[model samples]
Target chain A: MAAIAKSSFRKTKTKNAVLPYLYLLPAFLIMGVITFYPLIYQVIISFTNFETTHLLLGLKSPDLRFIGLQNYIDIFTAALPVENFNFFRVLEFNFWWALSNVILHVPAGVLIATLLNAEGLWFKRIYRAVYILPVVVPPLVVATVWTNIFDERYGAMNQLLTNISAAFLGNADPIYIRWFEDVKPPIPGFLPGAPLTLAYYAMMVANFWLGWPFMSVVATGALQSIPKDLYEAASIDGATPVQQFWGITVPLLRPAMIPAAVYGFTLSFNLFNFVFFMSGGGPARSTELLVTFAYNLVRNLRWYGVAAAFAVIIFGVALIVFLITNRITRATQNYMEA
Target chain B: MAVNPQSTKNMFVRIMNINTSGQTAGRSLPLWKQLVFQLIALIILASVMFPIMYIVTLSFSSITTRPSKLELFPKEISFVAYRQVLDRPTGNPVTFIELLRNSFMLSMGVGAAALVIAVTAAYAFSRFKFKMREVLMILVFIPLLMPAVGLSTPLYLLLNQVQVKECKSGETAILPFTECSDGGKGKLQFNLRDSLLGVGIAMTASALPFAVWNLKGYLDTIPRELEEAAAIDGADANQTFWQIVIPLAVPQLAVTFFLGFIGHWQEFVLTWLFLSQPKDYTLAMTLYNMTGQYANSIPWNRFAAMAVIVALPVAIVYIGLQKQIVGGLTTGGVKG
Candidate 1:
């Protein structure tokens, strides 16, 4: 069949303008009601003393006080009735938590992916399959399971420790490691006010189990994207495997892993479930994440206004995070611009 | 690791086909290094499998009490735990079937709702050159940056306001329930935020940004020339979009839907926060309820079985669609 003549069958610009909005109308409706409207409402409630009593009529409740940023002021100055809670300490701990997760997960991911990426590795398929299992399990399950695993008595961690001692040091008694209940920081003064307790270490172990496979999966995808001929060329150029890794593999993996690390950082920073479910922000609220703390304000204390204020503060921090990470990883950059 | 797990890979390179290499030193590790890698892999595998094996083992055990002994494997194969878990997951009146149904409905509902709205928005962003396009895109995605739990307070309050009052008006809808906001008084009927529907709405709100972004990326990759060709054949914009573009986007639509499905299925925070009724309980919530009890009161085997029930569907779905999900996942990170 002969090619048809090219024609301007598309709608006029003025008419077409409405078309895009029409496409977006439903999205905006849902998002507006659920996201933006609530966001604005959250901002509004942050200024008032909204609590459980206000749940019925919201700000319209006659008893609700318009506190005029008193909640924010109270939070910043630690004037809230909540115990052992410091705003800046949670912020500092949040950053440290995210940074530490990235510090551990990224390198370990790269290394594991590199090892698994090696040609002719036996049972590599099985290994990859096994490692990916953790990724599939829900975080709720992971958190609950890990909490039990770190249980002082029936926990597998203490049991494993007990077994190790029995084999090497002739002590058959069960070891009790109060991973969640321990209050004292293992390394005191390391993070200043935000003490990193034994629970933090246990959390790191659980999250490590939770976090690495994803990075490894990301790294593996990046590894395959790397030109095999680059490795072949490096081999011919007398570059050792170590040198090849440092030179070709690491640099190429950067584009992929950098974005992933930033994503991981943000995720770990906001990780509410693991922190909340594992320790309940406990052992004197040492391992609390910002989100978890904000949640606790509403859940346990019924301090809705303070929780709103805390949430707004979190939004600001998240904005800063988005900006910094946008600069570093360009994760949200549009397709054309990138 | 409370992650949605949208990032594991096997798209272009099948796991079985990972080592398609000639016997050359350039690719393969040395004999000793291979052994070392295997050893390390085994250690990691064992550590990773420890919790999973423990859960599976305990689920199959007849004992209901928490095992103090270091038992990693199933000594006896029994379905008592499963039977108990299925019969009654918690002390709450909810049955396992209701839990599963709630989980299925919330996840599938949010997944479908998000997909329908997201695909259109993604298409507009992909194909149109309009003012505030970038602004609107950023506006929609701003929520994605904020921790979802942070937004829960407002959502809870907002949706909570939309309640049904059991008034003389025969179950009237009320915002802020002002006793019908008239002279007559009405009892508070249904709090929207305190039900599965309200939680579903919230999840959809949270689920939208990611779905829109992911689908938009896919839509952008689809060429305009196909639509142009259809246009030359006398097709209008909607016709072309429906006939040409949507069919093309089917695979990606599935990808976005399943990705969100996995997360929503496992979601406990919103449902746990919003719903108080035992009948509205999801599998995740029931499982959570079982764990918060004292160790002595807790039935360990039943808890393990509940966990398996909650985890199995998601695990199966992830493994089945690992390649497509991870591929869609990597394209975003790598491209960005």
Candidate 2:
């Protein structure tokens, strides 16, 4: 009797174990083929000298050459065959880009959300409604439209600048600023290695507009979580509004803001379409991001092995960012882990 | 005196405010302060609306070519740009309707495909007490960390393998060989990597993880007692899942599908990389193409019109489903 019960129990256990994997099979099969396979394949190709020429037979071509760590070394040493490519400069600029975006966006988001959170504000719904517009507009669209706006000739940006110049400075040569093509970094040596071109400034302005709304969404979520009585109590204690804000609101928003900043760091670190589409990495790849560089290595450059190695390096950078951010914020910890 | 039930209920409502996106009435600010807040909001809104208004205005103008003036609103509302856009979106042989159809099919097909697969997997995650659950979940989600564009190279090579090549024997052989030992090496007949079908297949990979993650979270909320009760009433496990869990999870399924659908709709990189033919060009692909072309050749008004058209579906969906969409996004930890 004991043996029979144990067998049945074991049978049930085995059955239950198989069911989840069975359910997971279809999703994972597609994922394995499409996502996981490519990732694994990328890591493998990073060591080999894979290019478009070898694309026909991939890994098995008679002409395919294997050069272990050469691709990685080239990238690190800035010895890449492609012109105007430096790994460190791009990486540094990536960090700065993310940091600058966060500095501007987080405060603006928190401030706006806080104002909206102030008990009863008129048209609060409308204000929040407008916030969704940016969220709905994909980064690709945002980049494209902003590029149009900043056009040197017929762009609204030059027009606006011309209009402003005529109004204030009393001189306007159509305010034709080559926002994208002009690679002369306005602030030379400002961001060492990476040139902060006029395109960078334009991207910043556009990204700021694209960015703050999402941050505001996140900040609003945090703001709603703050107990209202804390504010009321501060008011009763004769604390000034500014005092209340700094003391109560800032501390409360820290938990959300830190994680948000971290996530934004990684997002902007790898932000491809916005930077790429804006000016095609800004004239000779001066404004090229790591991801876009990887993209170009494949699409335009056709240096497949170099692209794979670059992608692996990027993956490493992302992993490190994720790990460090995950440690600091534990933001990605799902409910079970938390 | 006991704690008032009404006040407790109010507290609960306030606590759940994040769910309703905090639209409930809290204590009103000072009237003057409220006015100040209003002023700030108006300024912010104006700034956000600046570029959007330009695109809308430009799309409606009588000018077929790119406008050279700073017109925030249309001087005369003409439908010519819209008509031309609808008629001929770009220099490509494909029509606006064809582009729409391609985009619609891909998004909807991928959305539905991911949904079906994800629901089953999410149900497993929610219901099963499996050993590898945590590890599996992490593995599924970790791909999102890698910049999607980074994965394009491998996907490019992998999908490139599935093609039909003609042999020296004047026969077509469909094989999964990147290095083809051909029945024929002369004519390349069908290449999966360059087709719309292959593009959809590749996109579904990126879409699946998000789908699984979103549905898993929703599925966890469903009480197991319903399934238990169904089991007690002689329902099988499969029956309980289909009849019980799915119905409860329908709204969430819609949420997951739409969220993934939005991304799929705007997907540019993989589609552009994979597809070469104009017939497979999505709205986003075409939009990016217009921007890449020579400045003089680009029909700027039509570009603006297409921009409006592309943005319309997303805006309308978001406007219609803000509460559900917003709630879903925040809970799922939005990408970007």
**Using lDDT as the measure, which candidate wins?**
1
Residue A148's C-alpha lDDT in candidate 2? 86
| C-alpha positional error of residue A237 in candidate 2 after TM-score superposition, expressed in Å | 0.4
Model 2 chain B: ten consecutive residues of lowest lDDT? B1-10
Chain A alone, TM-score per model = 0.92, 0.91
CAPRI-wise, candidate 2 is: acceptable
TM-score of chain A of 2: 0.91
Ten-residue region with minimum lDDT total, candidate 2 chain A: A329-338
TM-score of each: 0.93, 0.90
lDDT agreement with native, every candidate: 0.83, 0.79
Chain B TM (all candidates): 0.88, 0.86
Q: Best TM-score goes to which candidate?
A: 1
User: After superposition, which runs of candidate 2 have C-alpha atoms over 4 Å from their true positions?
Assistant: A1-11, A119-121, A331-338, B1-38, B167-170, B177-184, B231-236, B334-336
Which pairs clash in model 2?
B166-B184, B166-B185, B167-B183, B167-B184, B167-B185, B168-B184
DockQ winner among the candidates?
1
Model 2 residue B303 distance off true place after TM-score fit, in angstroms: 0.7
